[model samples]
Target: MTATAAAPEEDGTAPAGGGTASGQDASRPVRQIVPPEDLHATELAFLAAHDSGPRPPGWRLTPRSVVTFVMGSHGAALTLPDDARAAAGTPRRLVIDGKFVGDRALVERCVVTLAGERALLLVGEPGTAKSMLSELLAAAVCGTSGLVVQGTAGTTEDQLKYGWNYAQLLAGGPSPAALVPSPVLTAMSRGAIGRVEEVTRCLPEVQDALVSLLSERRIAVPELAGGPDGLAHATPGFNLIATANLRDRGVSEMSAALKRRFNFETVGAIGDLDAETALVRRQARAALERSGAAFQVDDAVLEALVTAFRDLREGRSAEGWEVERPSTVMSTAEAVAVAGALGLAAAYFPGDRDVLELLPGHLLGVVRKDDPADAARLRGYWDGPVRRRAEEGAATWRALWDLRTVLEG
Candidate 1:
């Protein structure tokens, strides 16, 4: 996903979608945020019940079942064969919940890559949910998504390998107890999933550390050469999932050697307007509910908001008219932020205020980040598209166009 918001929104908390995808358990007093591993345990258990298929070493699910788990059952119940059910010694109702929404073919390829225990790279624009997809894949393939290293400018090679525990190092010198394995090292030793978020953000040198770890499937520890803990070899079922922002590709480009070891897949924006709108609303409402705020935002306002974002995002109106896009990324994640902000204002501020009017200012805020000239780009968008829509008898556009001075100011 390209950077969704140019910068993090003030209230950028992701809506809690955990173990319960159908609906929150009413028996729960408060909302709980669980990791993908914990969240999908029940569904995984169900799938495993019916899956008598051969699996790769150390894998929890077969590649076919892994895809089914992530893509969901498409409103159909996944019934097991009578023989398989008998083998499981339990009733099977594997409702493969649809979690991630994108190309099914691409998802299958991702599942295949992990099944092969090869590194997989998820590349896309910000807010494209690459991170989420990685989590889901990791959890599904190995049954754990907690082993992770967040890549950044400050990220070090030690974060990908091992660091010394100061206390143990001081007392016992170089030993296994003094060694603190990074998430990557731990994953290699235990044969679990290890994730690296925003790989391009790491320094080139630090990023290169992956080349050997991935190629050899192990890490050498000269400090323990004569002892029992000389090296950590990757067990079967160990793999790495790294996500990199497409927009940041050139910043710290991965070495060709590192790139060659992994399969690459790019995730794109949601193509269907209604699908995208429904997702925005669903996530927004979840965010509202998590905050214990009543969702009072109107549907039309939401439709208009998503429409405006879609328009600004692609530099064109829904009617196929041209509109200039700002330099900033207008990701769906940003739309969620705007919607969340509007909903909060409606619940707390409590007025007969036109929620739509606040849109221009919020949009202005989204565009006026990163680049100084993006402000001018936003103005041009208003003058071109907003002006045409207003003149074409769109009352909401006319109202928004009336706030032209807001941008000028």
Candidate 2:
């Protein structure tokens, strides 16, 4: 009935013991389950055995379950039983963390592309959760997303292929011990997901390392003394997922060959207001709890904050009044931070002044991060849309326009 309500089980009954509140006569008390540190290959194997679809080699779940894991499952809750949850020594629920927040279709495309043995490339603006999505996808399929190469201006070919252990190479003369595998090579050996973040940030030559790896499915280490095993061939379910920031356009472009080798998916910003508000609320509460701070902000306040963000971000009011969007990204992350700030303000200031009133100021501060042009953009939003809405007599818009001085100053 409510958003926070516990969804019913398959048998059309409430979850075991009716609710989290258990009576003395009940078998066990309910406990909340948190995710574990590492999701191992064996653990993946077990889940795959029970998983309901055709699984690819080395993958724990079918592509469907893998999607459910990253996007969350609503059909059947995979929570631990109450008794199991309460048992001290018993293992907790196998919680799959969903790091990405956008489309189910995008996630499915990424998974499908990987399964097809194609390198997957995620392209998106800054702060669009491109890196986070890659990490979750890798973790879900391979049981670990730890094998990562952070691509930057200084990224080298050795970082993509392999580097020799200097001491071992000198003494033992390029044996297996001397052959140091890069994350990509390690994933190839283990049949796991290898990640390259900000791939476009790397120089053209460095980016070319991926071209050979994807097409040939092996890395040639000439320094290792040529041998059959010296060329690392991907076993199975081994694929690379790389993210490139669209905002960083001209930094370092990938070669045509490298680009052609990968299937690309573009991630977009949050478009749903309610979803964005809930995301902000969830993250704000989590932040407060993590810091041992109490949360008391009202839902209406959060809605208003999200609404303002959406309006400024899209350069239009909900009813279609025109505004100018700032250059800064109005990501869900920024909304979460603004909500957290309001919560802290409420805790400290303790006033009747509505939290929504603090939005324009906080938003101005967020938008005016590094450039004066962004401040001008905020002014344009106020002068155009805010003015129009105020003239049309929307009380909330009028009040927000009154606070335009906050941005101007």
Candidate 3:
């Protein structure tokens, strides 16, 4: 049966005691990462009003609009129809910015999978924004992205299915008041999308807990059997989206049965250099802005940073030169982080060192993460690409080539 959507707080988070805050800090930190629901609340509301088409059970926006929300409007302004504008009370026109930098078809497929209420699994190397995509999808499909179970080796079936409040359970026996529902269970009852991050990291048995939930679409509560709350049936809109790091392939393999339940989508690194560089600059600027500082890193430096990361990540250079790949994944996410660090350094330590001078050291840090031997591989990269570019009269490469001593120490 279809269930009405729960009213979310202004921040798009579930109300207190709703079990969405499990494993989260009670107090809000100053520099906290905002959830997609809160970050794009206006976009979500606007899209909801913009698209008056039919939505699947419990969805906030139509399937087409959900895809548009994730992939953006392609620099065009979206306007709400007159009836929607008057009723929804949102802006008449809004230009939605693209959040995830990937193929639009991939996002369309994801939206279709969610519309079908099937389990969606996003698998990729670390930092491909798999989790971000999952959050965006959940926030758009439902009203909130707060229902989450962070899967880890220590994860238990209780975390995936249900748990109990010791005090309540002690005072009263096996009642709804005494039984604490997990985020998944809460999502089932509320008919909202629930997210499981790093699902493969959970123990095999722990991960298998979801097999039955996905197949049966309900959790049998033997404790409350024969009562009104005996079986926790999933509301019409309930579904799950999970993410796994390809790097963590063998930590805890998912059961074959569990794999069959999910539609696996592999999220790969960005293909175009200019797009990757733009994303890095944009994210780095946002990071610096959060600290009340301007991003002063040069465009050339940002492009170089991304280029080096791509080279190390792909084991080949832009000029078709073969370079040694590092054991650690030189992900685009890491490039953004390094770019942000460079911006922070430039802003706080003005004139102390050229941001270009800091690039080699940051590259060294990223390379040395997995193997100390990777340090030499980075040096080989410098001697190969950096040296070649320097010989070609590129000033940026010359400056980077001059910093070869940084990698030596």
State the number of backbone clashes in model 3.
Answer: 0
Looking at model 2, how many pairs of residues clash?
0
Error of 1 at 78 (Å): 2.7
Can you list the residue pairs that collide in candidate 3? none
Q: Model 1 scores what on Cα lDDT?
A: 0.81
Ten contiguous residues with the weakest lDDT in model 1 = 1-10
Flag the better candidate by TM-score, 1 or 2. 1
Give the per-residue Cα lDDT of candidate 2 at 396: 74
| lDDT (Cα, tens digit) per residue for candidate 3, span 1-409 | 1112334456443332211222123353533466777666667878888888899999989999999888888777777777785334345666676888998889988988988858999999999999989999999999888999998889999999898888988887789998889999999999999999999899998988899999999999999999989999999989999999999989999899999999999999999999999989988887777677889999999999999999989999999999999899999899999999999999999999799999999999988988899999999999999999999999999999999999999
TM-score of 1: 0.88
Candidate 3 residue spans exceeding 4 A from truth: 1-31, 85-89
Candidate lDDT scores, in order, read 0.81, 0.74, 0.86
TM-scores of the models, in the order given: 0.88, 0.80, 0.92
Ranking by TM-score: 3, 1, 2
lDDT of 2 by residue, 226-343 (tens): 5666566789889999999897768888888988999999998888887787778877876665555667788866886788778877778888877677878777778889999998
Better of 1 and 3 by TM-score: 3
Backbone clashes, each candidate? 8, 0, 0
Model 2 — TM-score against the truth? Answer: 0.80
**What lDDT score goes with residue 199 in model 1?**
94
